[model samples]
Target: MEGKSWIFKNRPAIVASGVVGGPFEQKSPYSGEFDLVKDTLWMEEESFEKANRQLIESAIQVTLDKKTLSSNDIDALLMGDLINQITPTSMAARTLSAPYLGLFSACATSMEGLALSAALIDGGYCQKVLTGASSHNAAVEKQFRYPTEYGGQKPPTAQWTVTGAGVALIEKASPHNAPLALIEKATIGKVVDNGIKDPFNMGAAMAPAAADVIERHLNQTNQTIDDFDLIITGDLSRIGHPITEDLLKQKGIAFKSGQFLDCGKMFYPELPDVQAGASGPACSAMLVYSHFLNELQKGSVRKILSVATGALLSPLTFQQGESIPCIAHAVELSSPAVNSQSFRGEE
Candidate 1:
């Protein structure tokens, strides 16, 4: 990996994906994008944590079912969540029982998992890998701050963590099975700390990191923003979206974020309670696995970059008065029919 970026020659194919969303997600514009939607946030589980595990597990099961494959067919499973020690994800992964690798990147875990999965397949280490991310609003709120029952007043900048799970099975290109999207390249980001200690204002803390990775990805690929049909950032919410746009312009990469989609903003624009927009690991996972991949299949989009951002802060760290360190990972996704020449266009 040259300076946290790798260009894949083996271009693995995302064969199938599954998404599960909570009741609030059902209210979102793209609710129909999910394969399974729960009528309630609890998902009929006793505790919110158990329900979170159910979300991730449901996604894995559905994805496997769609492909008519089982854990035996999957070489490995990589997944992550925002909960402490990724407890929910670990609990869910046990059911898969494949050679599992659990990841922790706060929210950027989805792209982190995707980048690694592509590398594994491209490097000839595995034929197929299933990877994804999950996050629950209640679980996150209770762990990171106050419980939802506490009824704490969140600031306008605070974002609602998405309650959902999304998983995808990626494998080498085959003659019979057409892939949803092709993994072109990836740029891994470094930790960025802007000294913003407020955990509620995650957007401000993560905006710089998102811009940094976008710049690095474009530079490494020798391309510009316009080269891709869309540049998406995960869970930036309302506050961080414009700030990231402004940061990119300041770096001399002139563009408008309106041309791109922020998962947080698009998830539930009609829900007034989502002050900024949706967030957490599940936000980007759900959007990509459903909306963008569906569009790519329909030929509505040719090429897109999925950049999932994360705030690397723990409840203890925040309470101890440490600044929020953040990261972002970008993965290039494109329709198999799209000409790769566009990726070679610029300096």
Candidate 2:
């Protein structure tokens, strides 16, 4: 494939999606777009990790319900989260009883699943695959930083982990079913460590990796900045978003501010105490599956390049004074209307 980028010949279609969020996410500007919103993180579970698993299960249920399908209809389930060893996702898989593959890419887990789902469908390996990612604020905070109960203070660079889950039901394109969007291409990023060790400032550490993938995706796919209606990043927030823009310009690819946006910065514009906006596997998944897909369905936007970034460092690695290694995966999507036509980058 051209330097970690692959063009999906079959153009796997995203048929349906479901997003669930907690009380913290209810305040998000796009909260109404979510299929379900729980008033508390617990969701009647005894622990936050259990609650995280509940979120994933709920999201999967919502996705299946939207398409009027059951877990038995799903050929495979791919998902992950930020918890240790991604136990929450595995437990959810256990409940679903579907052939499952648990993934781990820190916050970038969502697009990683989506990319592989498209590849599998394009290659004729599977028919229908359920892929997604989830995260819990309290669960992740307790593992990465201090528990919310401890009232630990954070710097302005620290981002608030989102409490949410998002899943998508993807399958081979069919004349019988209309698609929400078509997965056109995918670019897998290389690991990039900027020598930053602070767990709080994840945006800075992930910015370079995001830029690297975006540049590679554009160049390898023979596209330009103008090819996409939007190029959105997973988190990166207020601090890292600008850093990514600057880095892209240095690489001979520049775009206007409106052309590029970050899910973290847009998720909680009016909310308070989110110093650097949202950061979690759910951040990008929730946004793309809900808002951006809805926009495509409404014909407001036709094409998008979504880059979900991840910090590969675990608590042990950071605690041991290791710099964070970051990565990003880019997935190009086109509206169903555009999918009917012969479309490619600038001739």
Best by lDDT: 2
Instruction: Estimate, for each residue in 207-240, the C-alpha lDDT of model 1 and write its tens digit.
Output: 9999999999998889899888899999898899
Least accurate 10 contiguous residues by lDDT in model 1: 338-347
Off by over 4 Å in 2: 342-347
lDDT to native, each model: 0.89, 0.91
Per-prediction CA RMSD (Å): 3.2, 2.7
210 in model 1: Cα distance from truth in Å? 0.3
- TM-scores, each model vs. reference: 0.96, 0.97
lDDT of 1 at 148: 97
Q: 344 in model 1: Cα distance from truth in Å?
A: 19
